[model samples]
Target chain A: MAQSRNADGNGVPPVGGPGAVSLALTVNDITRTVRAEPRLTLAEALRGPLGLTGTKIACDRGACSACTVWLDGVPVCSCMILAIEVGQRRVTTIEGLAEGERLHPVQAAFVAHDAVQCGFCTPGMVMSCAALLAHTKQPSADAVTAAISGHLCRCGTYPHVIAATVAAGAETKGDGP
Target chain B: MNRFALAHARTIADAAARATTTVADAMTAARSNATRPASLIKAGGIDVLDLMKENLLAPDMLVSLRDVAGLDTITEAPDGGLRIGAMVTLGALAAHDMVRRRYPALAAALAGAASPQIRHVATLGGNLLQRPRCWYFRAAAFHCLRKGGGHCFAISGESQYHAIFDNRPCAIVHPSSAASVLVALDAAIELVDADDTIRRLPLASFFVAPGRDTERENDLRPREILTAILLPPPAAGLCTAYLRQGERSAFDWPLAEVAVALVRNEESLCVHAVIVLGAAAPVPYRAQAAEAALLGRRVDDNAARAAARAAMEGATPLPRNGYKLPLFEALVHRAIMAAVAETL
Candidate 1:
């Protein structure tokens, strides 16, 4: 039973009890450790200790796709998964999708297509589209629609989102910059 | 949400032991009318986290079963059936090639359920064991009969989403679309008790009606873990189909859903039939009368309509939910017709 100190220098309790424990996560290809309670969700841990505010948490429940994140290359609701249960899986947030100053194909296409309005659901929508493109190089319109079906764009950018994802999928296939 | 201890179980034995100890504590606490559960098992945490966030459930301890080995594989059983681990996510189940080829109804049900994000994380066992999505039971403000309260709020208020059959003292419909298809396929669930003893229960018998027990929805006892689900080998010339009519085309619970599995003879005459309706009753409502109507008869359009009429024979709908009767009848007709058409 190992214990870690919190940021405030408080003595954290050992793991497997009703106290905070140190959890190591591989986020954006970097191994970051944070001490948090067992009940904390992956979304909360990422936003709080990891400071990855790119993943939004509009609905704390699993209904909203605002907290979507890639867990082991699959898009899952981070708000529904426990931080402690993430164990050794790779986590990719919206902030990790871009390389340096350049944007991922999905993000660039989103901007080009003007798919974002309020921008609250952009991160999640981008992550989902990126995951779809990571698997399918040339996704059809229906495929892109099905991929982002869980996400709710209150700004009603659905048509543009579909166009951007389809265009990004084709761009990825063509190896375009 | 309330603060509670968390226990990570690395083995199924360890999880059962922890659950057994906690169930005893929970039983003792129940004597004092404690609202909090003594312990809960978290597989995927989709439903558990929602209940916790809504303050509907407070557990003293959470026994996490994610680290348990051999709980996430889908394999072929010795009898040519499929053995799906309890922890296999809904997305994986729907996308599995074997499931798509052999159990298309189950795949369709899974694909239509919840959303892409939820299906990626929600496991089969958790989906089957999850609580009802009734507004009254989900909200902390409404102490419905399922929550150990004296009265059922849905009976008198907002009965549109409530059950239309077998809803006595409680009106919440069973929310698992997968379970309805599984029941039609005659699936069996494997359970591991705290003593390491294994038990198998037919999927149809797993859900308990409100008349039998108001506090719980299923037959799962304390200190028991649903380890796997076993699907029997497909019968000869068997054809299955699932159809759900939701309010929305995507990411919405079914207003009325039906799954039909029928085995036809070489001449295209029905030999056996099973029709299970979901979100229409407190349990997966088996249309036995409808099945009888299709026995030994050619499953033509006229016969399908007749069976559908028989399926709605004894449905006691609430004042607000009578619309479900016609809706369910239409689904039943479509499901049977589609299943019969598949045989051709």
Candidate 2:
């Protein structure tokens, strides 16, 4: 195998390792170094070595959005991305969705609206809904449904999820004043 | 997934050098009829990672294009043609103002594909070159022909979601929703070889039919990289639409899909038409007969039905999937009507 070589002056392209390499990932605004293989997924790394297990792995594939997280503030499947490939992008999981002691508006709304049945799909659901509220504060019911469309809640919490997301968007302030 | 060496290529040249070694290993393995692990290139790692986890492909090395510069932008040419880099995500492509206004069909195609998370992660290059999501091919126990095995399990097994037109060799339907719209827009693609040689050809030629070769879906090899997509300038009086039906409303594979592009003369007669079907066959199936049937005719309900009928001329549906025949015909009619409705 070709080792990490700085062939040109392009500033260290192949910087990781074939075995376990230390990665300085800026997850949730804090930089932490974790030793992992190139094949370890971001979700696996986040759950195992980092000990941040809020991001649940249901399907372990792209079929279910139970593993959704924020890559540079946009929602993406954490299970689908390799931890090493994340490079310099900021990662935000469910653990980073709130501030100090205040729950995120979507999280509060989920509690108020009884949106957690099995609670397996709640973390990723909250991430997608919170991302939607950040963009559109007064999102329509259809928009809320579209926001969490990728999420598969076998607990049949879709109606409550939509209602909670809609109320969360309405309660919170949007991008503009 | 097996442990593989990962290389983050800072430049395209760096990637090209790695591709040469990968292609060498691939050719050697192919010649020996051995199931040896070879090197591969991946950017988003959306579908490739899935393939790897399923034990379908175990690469020895992975040249990551995650941070490759100059391949993630969308630029408009001096002649108003659009040049989209391969690394552009579906979400970015659909949200572009130029794409939404000039090519509504393409915008629709990109919007209707996958989910919000997938759209943000999976690139357009990976979408076009993605492998078919066949049950037999995906399962390790089947050992289908696409994996260089003996038989196609879908032929005698559960084939409800299989192909209707091309049912002899393999029953797996192509899964790209944007490909049909791109073909309707007459897009071209750029592919870079291992020697850093760039070749641009029509996007239509990029696909390989199951009858031609059941082993591979597209012409891309593990060593080649799909670089860019070039969309020709929007035609005068061009109106287009893409419509698809899936089992579920969101984040689902297309059950029946159609993309229709047409140019109408001042007399309300169709002068040009292009109809392509997605998830219908092993390739983006072009309905040449349907296009010919609509030329120089008024795009009324009668004409639309006739053209849709013409589109299903050679369909040979399997026993379990004969429902797709009517589904495709109705989708074609709706797609044409949708495009015509946009004109008003």
Candidate 3:
């Protein structure tokens, strides 16, 4: 029930109803405590209170995967999820995809393969690829497309997104896309 | 800023307490700003959140049935039926070995929605409860009959996307892909009332036609939470599949979709058949006339074509959607052929 001083800055009421939800969400093995309205979307909580803007919100609706994040090892649209609902679950955002500023393989491949354009959907594309790689060391070409199809890049980065996902999968096995 | 809220429901009673009022009450409250009434029922935020941002929905409070607990499991009943928790994600159900093998049609429907990300978040309960994807209903410009207006604009307006059957008052097609498939599979809905009382009804009975109530979509009352869906196991020797002919490969509503489940006897003659059409009416249009054609006949090419034609028998087309008749005819043929191929 402790207050966190209106952390999200949106000034919206709590999604959890009148009280600050006290909990810690594990982001990339780092425990960060949050005091937020239960209604706070995971995207807002991560980018606002936590100052991790790597998780972007393209459509705010679940349509675009620009707000993708890893929840309990599964890739999900962060904008559609409530922060309090996450509770003590593990949340790995695009910011958490790397190990100490060393670019995650997905992020690196995104650059090597020119998988990013306008950089709006890059963060989500990276996070989704990371999650796909975690579960699948070497996914088929269709698997890569399905993994990132939910994400939309208005700049027409779909080919690159697909390329990046395939590249990441290949990298997991020390091969090529 | 548009923000989504999640209200936790500790139990069915708690969830009902947090649910929106009657359809009339919800519309009034939503229009009146005192509450904005912008909340959603979160079983799977997959389709719900999309409608919200599209301005098709503006719920003020999201009742999170996720915490209602026990709503995410699939259990086998003594009657050899399957009871699926409302909170169970489509991915879970589609991937469940039993469902994939026993109810391949359901798995195909789930896999057709969006991508793995959506299938992972969309719940069976939410899938069945999703609103129609009619252009007139979703857009803010038109005051259609389904929106409680006097006339159904789709009857004459831009209705290539409207219903092809049950074209009386409203013409918007049923948008729940899973519901159509479930209906063909002969499932039932499990409901929990505001007073915590539970009830069950056949899945086919859950939807109401616009001819019956132009303003409402389903039979759900205010404060009634759809807790789970129970599918009586597929009939013996039954083969099922859902065929959706969409405008695109991803994230688009079906222009015309077909759900077919057939139970063939030892001699390869049909004993039971259920065919439901989506994007063809206000509710899932069960092609009873078409099903009747297959009652005793062997499902050959001629029988499949005749059944397909029978299903489209009473369709009254709008100006733009006249093409749907022939398109649906083709889809129905494909569905029947696929279902028939299973025996081979």
Each model's backbone clash number: 0, 0, 11
User: What's the residue-level lDDT of B235 in candidate 1?
Assistant: 93
Using TM-score as the measure, which candidate wins? Answer: 2
For model 1, residues B19-52, the per-residue Cα lDDT tens digits are: 6332212322233246534766778888877888
* Residues forming the 10-long window of minimal summed lDDT in candidate 1 chain B: B22-31
Model 3, span A73-144: residue lDDT tens? 788888988777786778888776666878888888889889877999888888777777777777776877
Lowest lDDT 10-mer window, candidate 3 chain B? B23-32
Decreasing TM-score order of the candidates? 2, 1, 3
DockQ for all models, in order?
A: 0.45, 0.73, 0.34
TM-score of chain B of each: 0.95, 0.94, 0.91
lDDT of 3 by residue, B157-238 (tens): 8888888888787778887888889999889989998688988999888788876877667888767888889989667788
- Write down the worst ten-residue block by lDDT for model 2 chain B: B23-32
For model 3, the superposed segments whose C-alpha errors exceed 4 Å read A1-15, A18-23, A174-177, B1-6, B20-25, B28-41, B46-61
Candidate 1 chain A, poorest ten consecutive residues by summed lDDT: A5-14
TM-score of each: 0.94, 0.95, 0.90
Candidate 2 docking band: medium
Give the runs in model 2 whose Cα sits over 4 Å from its true position: A2-15, A175-177, B20-37
